[model samples]
Target: MDKNHPKSISLTLAFSLTALIFYLPANFFPFMSIELYGNRNTSTIWGGIVVLVESGSWPIALIVFLASIVIPFFKLAILFYLALTATNGKHLQLKLKLYNITEAIGRWSMLDIFLLAVLVAILKLGPWTTVEPQMGSLLFALVVIFTMVASASFDPNLLKENPNGKVS
Candidate 1:
């Protein structure tokens, strides 16, 4: 199928755009804020990782850092590259495999969101230590969801090029 196919191209473009837009704020904003003992503390996803590492939970910290920070950004970059190359009729077998892997990992990128949600739910101590959702969480969620949709919507056939170096 050609890249111009409405459903395939449009959905891929939409998801890629959304992922690009949301990724910025997701990394910049605080993911969670905690108010305890008349003091407020904030943590971005990375900040949480630092705290975890400092507290000697290195494994959990690394997992969260990689899954939440590294994976999402990597997935977005891969998706954008795939979409651009596909639209330009470039073909690469490895690109297709990378795209599929990105799609598979996209869902796991939501682990940070799930962790935040759980923290907020379980740590609501009514003025002791309250975890509030922050803008970063929202943006992060958007990034993950959009990437997932983009992967699903992308036309895998676009990766195949004709003899003339144009999409068939």
Candidate 2:
């Protein structure tokens, strides 16, 4: 991998772009739908957070917002910065640390999906409340996966290499 660090960066950029592309619909489109007492409620990721905030669960709302919305965008921005700085010969260590952070916190971004899955499984109470995942949830999962792959494929050492991002 060291011998081909530049190539890894290229692949990382590709995956990061793909993840960013998936991010839009994941936030705006309906993530899940719940049916209860013959009423249906559809919610996107941000809508869930808004509902939580409105319902007085401020802490949970903040957590979901941070994990789902803030962190993904942070990771994407950091990845973009890392890729740019790697070739521009600037902020090598800071960007490397940021890269480590993005890699470490990557999985936690899927918390919303995990919670929804658990709710769907346990809420099978005969027309009381049934939760079903929608297309946006799948896209969000893909975004997480793609970003994780991008982070791992990124060679932080390349940031300190030549201005062209070629390995020594």
Give the candidate number with the greatest TM-score: 2
Count clashing residue pairs in model 2: 0
Residue range 1-168, candidate 2, lDDT tens digits: 356564877888899999999999889989999998879999998899999999999999999899888999999999877776676666667877887798789769778778888888888856677788998899999999998888888887676655556533
Q: Total clashing residue pairs per candidate?
A: 0, 0
Instruction: Give per-residue CA lDDT, model 1, range 9-34, as digits (tens).
Output: 66787888988899888888998899
Alpha carbon deviation, residue 61, candidate 1 (Å)? 1.5
| Over 4 Å off, model 2 | 1-3, 125-127, 161-168
Cα lDDT for residue 165, model 1?
75
Q: Given candidate 1, what's the lDDT at residue 5?
A: 65
CA-lDDT, candidates in order: 0.81, 0.84
Per-candidate Cα RMSD to the true structure, in Å, reads 2.8, 2.9
Against the true structure, candidate 1 has what lDDT?
0.81
